[model samples]
Target: MKFFPINKEEMNKLGWKECDFIFVTGDAYVDHPSFGHAVITRLLESLGFKVGVIPQPNWRTIDDFTKLGKPRVAFLVSSGNIDSMVNHYTVNKKRRNTDVYSPGGKAGLRPDRADIVYCNKIREAYKDVPIILGGIEASLRRFAHYDYWDDKVRNSILVDSNANLLVFGMGEKQIIEIANLIAFGKNILDLKDIRGTCYITKDIEGLKDYIEMPSFEEVKSDKLQYNLAFKIQYQEQDAIKGKTLVQKHGNLYIVQNPPAFPLSQEELDFVYSLPYIRTYHPIYKKDGGIPALKEVEFSITSHRGCYGGCSFCAIHFHQGRVIQNRSKKSIIDEAVKLTTLPNFKGYIHDVGGPTANFRNPSCKMQIEHGVCKNRQCMHPTPCPNLEVNHDEYLDILQEIRKLPRVKKVFIRSGIRYDYLIYDKNTKFFEELVKHHISGQLKVAPEHVNDEVLFCMGKPSKKVYERFEKKYHELNKKLNLKQYLVPYLMSSHPGSDLSAAVELAEYIRDLGYNPEQVQDFYPTPGSLSTTIYYTGVNPITGKKVYVPKDPEEKKMQRALLQYRDPKNYELVYKALVKSGRTDLIGYSKKCLIAPKKIRR
Candidate 1:
C-alpha cells in the first residue's frame, strides 16, 4: 500500500544498496495505474525487483539524475502520460499556461522534449547505465516523423536520445522479457530480437525478412517519400502479421521489431490487479496534489487497445488496434473495492477504456490473424466480419449498479456511437439511456461533412444523425431528459471553408452551441498530421486541402461558435469566403446577420 522508494532517504529506509531499475519521468509521481510510470514500476516490483523512481527530474542539471544512483540493470525514461512537446505547447505552437500533470496545476515543471532531455542527463551522470525509452512520447516518435512545432521532419527519437532501446506500445510483454534477460547476465546490446522494441544498428547484414523504409534524409526532404514511409508503417502495425521494419539514418539504421503480442485475458487482468496506491505520492500534498490524478482517481480502466481507427488518434500506434478486456469477475472485484475507499462518493467516474462499448476483439479474424493491413474494421461502413454486440458491457454495468454503496456507475469515456447503433438489438442503448447516463452522454462526431470524415477516417455524418435520432427516441421512451453532446472539431485536413460551412450549418440547424472545439493538432504519429504536412492522404495518395493559414483556421473555428456575438465577424467572413452569402440574410436558417450593429 506504500509507494516505491523515490529518494535516497526512502531507499536507505528500505536497506537497498543499489536499485535494479530507476524510472525517470516528466510527471509528478502518482502511483496510480492511470500513470504509465506507475504501472511499469509496480509491475516490476511485483516480480521481486527493486525499482526506484525519479519523477520530474531537473533536466538543466545532472543533480536530480544522480539522486537515485546507478541501477544494476537499466534506467527507464518516459515523457509522462503525454508527449512533452504536446503537453508544453498548444496547436498554435504557443507555450501553454498550465500543466495538469504538475503539482498545483503549474506550468514549465518539465522541460520540452522531456524524454530526450532526461535521457541525455542520465548519460551525463552515469555514462554507461542502460537507458530504455517508453511512454506515449517515445512510442509515437520511435520512427522518423513530422514535428509540428519545428515545422519539419525530425530523426527517430532513438537516434537523438542515445537510448539503448525504445519500447513502443504497452510494454508489459517487452519489459518483462528485457528485465529477465538483462538480470540473467545478458548485455543490453544483444537484446535486439525482442518484439515491441527498437534499437540502432550499424550492421544490416544480420537483418532478414524486414521491410526497409525510405531513409530519414529522403523522408525529411521529399513530401512524397514521407507519405510512402508513413503508409508502409501504418499497414504493418498488427502484432500477428507485422514484420520487423528498418529505416536508415545516415550510416546507422533504426530497426523496429514486430509489436509485442497483446496480453491474454488473464495477463491483462493481472496488470490491473497489481497493488497500486491509487493516488499521488504524499510528498506532493503540500502543493495541493497533482491535478491529473483527480479525473482518473475515481475511475477504472476496464480494458486496453482500441479498434476505432480514427486517423487523428495515437492509440492505433501505442495500444494497437486490438481489443483486450478483463473478465467480468475481475471488474466486479474492482468495483467492490472502490466502495471501501475513504473518498467514495457513491459514483464510479467511469468503467471503460479507449472506447467504452468495445469489450472484445472487433472480429474473430482479428483474434486469429490480426486487424486488416489495408482497411479499418469500422470506417465508411462496418466490415462484414465486424462483431457488433454490447451485451457483455451491459452486463458489467448492471452488475456494478447493483453494488452496495455505488449509487451511479457512469461511462465518461468516448463511446463509439456508430458501433453502438450497428448493434441490431437496442437493449444496451435502452439501458444506457435509463441508468448509465448522468444527465449528458458525450460522443465524438468530429464533423458533419462526409468528405471531411472520409479524410479523417471517421464515420459519415448520416451515421451520426441516425445515432442521434435513436438516442433521443430512447430517452423519450424511458421518460428521461438526458442529452447527447456531440463533440465537434474544426480545421482538420480536407476541411476547407466550404466544409467548415457545412458543419456550421449543421450546428445552426441543431440549435446547439459547443463550449469547446478541438482544432487539428499535428502531433507526431497520426495520419491526419501526415496529411497536414504532406498535403495528401498517405494511404490513398490523393491530394487534400489543409487549412493551415492562421486567419482561415480562426474563421473555421469561429464558425462552430457562430451564435456567439464575439464570433459574428469571423463567421461572416467564413460565409462570404465560401460563397454562401445568400444564407447571411434575415432568416431563421441564416448563420449570421448580413452586417453587425454599429456601437
Candidate 2:
C-alpha cells in the first residue's frame, strides 16, 4: 500500500483481517519522516506487520477511535510531534488560534493533554487492549513533572494515561523490540525490562540496581525535592551508562529502564529509506491539506539528537544527547527523490536536524562511556575532549547542491556558534557563507547577559559577539549582503529588569530592530521549566530569580522590541525601574526619546 490504512475498509483491501498495530495520533496524517507517527508506522510496515494510522480522532466521543476497531498486537498513541499543551497554547497560557499540524491549520481538532485523552478514549472502546505510548509528549512526560497549565506537579504520563507501555527517546529500536516481544506471546507486564521503555510495577524487589527519585507527592509539596528529582532524572539520560529510574506515584511505581542504544549508521539509513508518500493523506486534500507538511515537504533530516544541552530545549530529554546521523548516501538519495516530486520547486528548505552543525558525537569517550553526568559539552565552555569537525557534513551539503534540478540548499536549523568557533577550520564557515545562506541566516543568542546565558546553559555573550563579527566578515569577503537574524528571548529564569535593559542595549548596538521575539515558555521536562517552578537550578542547586508577575514579564518582552512605538511606555517604565533612565533620554546613544522631547 502507498499509504497505511486509516479505516477498516482500507485494511480489508489489503486482505488483512485485523491490523497488527493501530496508531492513534493528534495530527493530520502526513506520511513524512518528520512526523513521529509516520516514522514509527512505516518502520512497523517494513517489518512485515500490518500497521494502520488514525490521525486526530475526536476525543469527545468513542466513534472516531472505534472506526479502526481493535488491533491484534497493540494500540500506539502519541500527541503527534510535540507535547499537546505546547501545541495548543502559547507562552502566555492563551489558547492558540491555529494548529499547523491539523487540517486547514484549524484549532480544536484535538483536545488538550492529547496523549491522556486519546488513551482514555481507547480504553473506553477496548477494555483489554495494550496501549503503547510514544512520541514527544509521552517521552518527555514519562516522569513526574511540573505542568505549566496546571500550575502544579503532576504524576507521570504513564500513570495518568494508563498505557501499558511507554517508549521514550527516538523509538526506532525500542518499538521494534516491543513488537517482537509482544508478537512472541509476551505480556505487557512481562516486558518491563526492555531498555528505552517505562512501565508501572507494584513490586521493586527483583529490580537490583536503579535510582529512586522523590515521589509524586513529595515533588508536589516540596520545591527542593522537586529540583532534586529533576537533577537525578536529567543526569541519567545516557544510553550507555544510564541506570533504571523509579518514581513513586501513590501505591504504584513508574519504572523507566535505561535508554536503548542509538541506531548504527546502516540502521539509521534503512529507517529513512522507507516507502513513504511524503505528503498528507489524500483525505486531507479537501481541507487545504495539512499546513504542517508544507514546512518540511522539501526538507531533509540529516541526523537526530543534539548535544548542545540548552536548558530550555526538550530535545535532550526526548532525542537524548548522543548524535545518530544517517549515511551520506541515504541523505543524498532522499534529496534526489525530492527533485522528482510534482511539487519540487528546485529549492531544498533545510538540510539539518536539531543542530545543523552537529553531525557526530561531541566526543569519542561518550560512545564507550555515557555523556558526562554533571557537565555539558558546549556550555559555559566547550570541553577539551570535544571533537569539532564538519568535513563529512560539508561534503554531503556540497554533493546535494550539485544534484540535478536542485537549485539551492539552505541550513535553516540552528548552528551552535560556540562549537563552530572551536573548529579552527575556516573552510566550512567560508563555504556556508558562499553557498548555503538563504538571504538571511537565523541564529539564537537568547540573551546578552552572561548571568542569563549561564542560567540557560549557553555560551557567554562574548562567544556570540565573536560569532557575529566573524559572520559579517565572511559575508563581506564573499561580497554577499546576507543578514544575520539572531533570535532573542525575554523573561527567562535569572533575567531581571537589569538584564533586560542590557539586552536592549546590545540590540541598539547592532542597529537591528527585531521583528519577532520569544518569551521563555515553561514547558514540561525542560531544565528551565524546572528552575522556573522550583526557583533553583537543578544542576547547581543554586537559587535563581524568576519573573512571575505578568506586568514584569510584559515589560521584559517590551524591552526586546523597545523600538516599537507601542512599547514605549513599557520600555520607559522598565528603564526607570532598572535605574537606567539615561537610556530613555535624547542622547545619541539612548534607546528612546525623553517624554518632553516627543512633543
Candidate 3:
C-alpha cells in the first residue's frame, strides 16, 4: 500500500500506491498527545497494513474518499479528541449562546454529522467498503444520551452514523485486534466476540443473559450507576471484563462493549515514552513561510484523569477519577527533545493534563495499603486520601524550564485553584507565576453564585476571586503584567437568571471583558448532563433548576457576555422580572452593560 500526505509533493514521493485501508478522523491538530491518532497510524503501518491518514477530513463531500479508492478492510473514524460532544453543544439554545461548532464552509459542517455525513458520502461513493466508527464521540454516544441541542435525550450515534463497529475508550489494543481480524477474512458481523467495541442492534431478547441494560431512569439519575452498567456491558479481556449488551431497535442488535482497562502506570508511561515526531502543518509543506519546525514549541501532557470530582466535568468519568502520570524523567526527556527543534520560539511551554497540578495519584500512602476508592478522595469536601503534594511536579517543571532552549514554561491548562489554595502551598503559586506564566494564567471559576458553585462541587467564588486578587497583587508587586484569566461557564443546570446575573455583575466588578465565555454544553456521559436531564443533583439528591426552555438558557448564557445590548437588555429584564431589581444597574451589573446605558 502507498501513503499520501495531505500535501501533494509528499503524496507523489510516496509513489501514489494504493493502500489497504484509509483512517479518517476529525483530530488533525498533530502536536496534541492525547488523541495519539498519529502514533496509532504509525503503529498500524509497522504491522504491515497499508494505511493512509485523512486527518480532519472534508466532511462536506465524497470527493476526498473517491480519490483514496476503496480499502480491502474498513475505514477508522474518530473525532481525535476523546468525544465530539465535549467540543459541541447538543442543545440548539446552547449552540446559539456559544460558537462551539460552527458549520464548516463546504469543508465544515455540523461536527456531529461531519463524521456521519462524510462516512455516508464515502458509502454512497463506494457501497461495498466497510466503515467503522470509534473514539470518544462514537463510544460515549453509542447509547442514548442527553442531547443539549435538542434539550432532550437521543439515541446512540452508531444508529445515526450507520458504521459497522463502534470502538470505545482507549482503542489501541482493540484497533490492532480489529485490523488482524478483518485481515483474516472475518466479517464485521462475525467479530462480535472481540471486546471493547460496540455494534448496532434492534433486539435485546436472548442477549439479556450476558448483559444487563439499565433503565433510563437509573442511568439518568446516577452517573456511577450508568458507568457501572456500561462497565458490565463492555468488559475487555485483560483489565476489567465486561459483557456485551444486545438491545433491540427495530430488528438490529446494538452491541456495546464495557469500559476498557484503565491504563496502568507502566502502560501510561510507555505511551508517553514513544517518540513525538511533531510535524509542521501539512499546508506549510510547499511554502517557505512555515514556522520553525526544528525547535518546535508544543504543549505536552504530564498526567490524565482528575480526582477532583466537579459535578459538571466528564474527565473523571471518561478518563477515570484516578490521576495517571507520565514519569517525571519521561516528561523532561520530551521537553529536552522539544528544545532541540530549530523552530522552537520562546513562547508558552505548557505542561498540561486534565488537571496539570495533579501529577501523581492523589493518595500515594493509601496505595501501599491497597486501600483505594475509585471515587474522588475529596468528595463532598476535601478528603485526607487526596495526595495533595505537587513538589514532584514542581521540580519537574523547574527542571524543564532550566533546559537550554526553553525560555518560558506556561501552564495553559486550567489550574485547580481550590487544590492550590487547599494545599496552602502558596510558594508554589508564587513560583508558578514567576516561572510558568506567559503574561496570563487561566483558572476556571465556572460560576460565581455560591449555590451554583456548590452544585459544581467547586469552592466559593470568593475563594477564587481572592486568589485572583492575590495573583494580580503579586504580579503588580513583582512589576509583572501577568494576570489571571478566569474561565466562566454560563447556563449550567443549577444556574438561575439571578445567579447568572450575579456572575455578570461580578465580571463587571472585576473590570475585565473576557475574550471568551463558555456556555455549558451538556455532553453525553457527563455528570452535568445527567443533572440537566434529571433536574436533580445525582450525588446530593437535591432538587436543581435545569432550565429546559431554550430562550431562558440563551438569556442566561448572554449574561456572561453581557456587553451585547440585546444580552444586557435580556438579563436586565430577567433581573427585574425575577423581582431582583436590587441587582439592576449594580456596579457589577453595569460592567457588562453597553457603555451608553451603564448608569
Candidate 4:
C-alpha cells in the first residue's frame, strides 16, 4: 500500500473530491506502526475511507487547519505517540533541544500541549466539525488527574479540548467503531457507549451500572478523595471485568466506557499488514527524514500488552496487561520484508514489545478472568499461577537470525530479569548471554532501598542481584565477556535523602558511575505519579514522602551520580542534611571531598 493523501493535489491524483477523514498530529508523519497516528489513519484508509494527514500543523492560525480543508466525516487529533509535555520538556522542566519526531530533529515544531492547542484551532476554524482526541496525551489524561508541570490537579483533557469525542487505549478498535458510527449518521455524542472512549454530557440520566468517581473539585480539595478516585479507576481497567466510569467537572459528567478487548492474533496481523511506507512523509525528504524512524524501521513487534506492570509505566492503563502475540509466521514474514528495505543492514533492531520475552498471558486464569485488580503478575513475588517461559521468544529470535540476508537479531527492548530468574530452564539464559548481548544488557533496578521499591511496585534489590550474578555466570561459562547496565531512578515518591544515600553506596560498591539518571516524572495515569501528587500510596494507603523541593530534588539526583565534579556541592549538602556527615571525607568510600576554602 502507499501513503494516503496529504494535500489537495494528492487527493486529486486519487480521484477524490474530498477526504473522508483528516488526521491532525503533533508528530511529523512517519507511516509506521510505531506511530499511533500512522496506524490509525492507514487502517481507516484500508477500510475504504479517504484519509488525509496533517502533521505538525501550524497552531498559530487557521491556515494549517484548512490546509486539507474540512473532512467529509470528522477531524482526528493526536499529540503524537507521547504526551506533548514529555516531548517538549525534560524531567527537570527544561526545554528539550531536539524533537526526534520533527524533521532534521527540530524543536518547537508543535505546541507545548499539542492536542488541546491544535483542537482549539480546529474548533475555531469549523464550529460544527466533530473533533476527536486520541493518542497518549488523551488516553492518559482522560480523567481528572494531577499535572506535575503545573503542580496541581487538573481536569480531564476531554473537557479542556472541547472535542466532541475521545478515544482512549490503542484506539485501532475504538477508532474504527467511531468512524462506523459516524458514517451511520449518528451524532458523536450519541456514540458514547463504545468501549475505549470517553465523552462529556450534562445529563447523567440512564447512566446506570457505572462507578461514579470523586468530582473534579473534590479531588482538588481533598487529597484522600483523589487517592480513592485513582484506585477505583485503576481497578476498573480490564475489558472483561471493568465497569463504566464517570467523573464530574462542574455541570458536565465525563463518562469513560470499559477498555477495548485485546485484538486476536488474526486481527493484529491484519492491522500490521496494512500498507505502511515504513518511513517519514516524503515532504520531509530534503530536511532529512524523521530521526524517530531510524531505530524502528527494521524492527518487528512480536506482541502487545505487558504483565510486568511497573508503577511508573502507563502500559496497563493504555495497552492493558492481557498479553497478545503475533503468530510466528506473521513475525517471520515481517522480518523477511525488512530484509528487502534499502536501508536493511542485515540487522533486525528488535523483536519485542513493552517487555521482551513475554509471549503469552502471565497465566491461563488471567486470560479468562482478566488481570487481578489488587495483585501483580511478577512483583513483590511472582504469583503462584504465573507462567514463566521464554521458549517461544527464543525460538522466534533464532529463526529470524537464520533468515537469508539477516546478519543479526538483537532484542533491544528491555527484558524482565526477574521473570528470567524464575524460569527453571537455563537454555534461554545461556543463549541470551551468548547471542543477545552486543556488549552489555540493560535492566531497570530502579533503586536499592526496599522501602522505596515497595512503593514503586518493584521487586527487592536481592532479586536483581540474583539475576546479575547468574548473567555473569552464564557469560563466563560461555567464554564471553559481557556487562550489565543497570538503569536507576532518583526522587521517586518514597525516596528521601536517606534512600538516595543508600543507592549511592550501592553504586560505589559496584564500581560504576552512570552517565545518565532519570528523575521520577509524574506524568498522568501512572500509579507512581498518583503517589507523587497525593503524598500517599493508594495501594497501602500509607503516607509516603515526596521530594518536591527543587533544591532537594537536585540533591537526591546528585547523589545518584556523586562522582561528577559539578554535583559535589549538591551531594555535600544532601549528605549534611541527612545527618550522614561520615559520608563526607577523604576515604575512598566518600562520595565527595571535604569542604575547600578559596582565598
Listed in order, each prediction's TM-score against the native is 0.99, 0.99, 0.80, 0.98
Instruction: Give candidate 2's root-mean-square deviation (CA, Å).
Output: 1.2
**Candidate 1 to native Cα RMSD, angstroms:** 1.1
The window of 10 residues in a row where model 3 has the poorest summed lDDT is 98-107
Instruction: Give the alpha-carbon lDDT of every model.
Output: 0.92, 0.92, 0.65, 0.91
Once superposed on the true structure, which residue ranges of model 1 sit more than 4 Å away at CA?
596-599
Per-residue lDDT of candidate 4, residues 459-542 (tens digit): 999999999999989988999888899999999998999999999999999999899999999888999999998888888798
* lDDT value for model 2: 0.92
Worst 10 residues of 1 by lDDT: 589-598
lDDT tens readout by residue for model 3, 16-124: 5566667776654353244456656655665787766666656567776666667777887677553544444444532323321121212232365455666677778
Q: Rank the candidates by TM-score, best first.
A: 1, 2, 4, 3
How many backbone clashes are present in model 1? Answer: 0
lDDT of 2 at 465: 86
Which parts of model 4 have CA positions greater than 4 angstroms off? Answer: 596-599
TM-score of 1: 0.99
Candidates ranked by lDDT, best first? 1, 2, 4, 3
Cα-based RMSD of the predictions, in order? Answer: 1.1, 1.2, 5.3, 1.2
lDDT of 3 at 402: 83
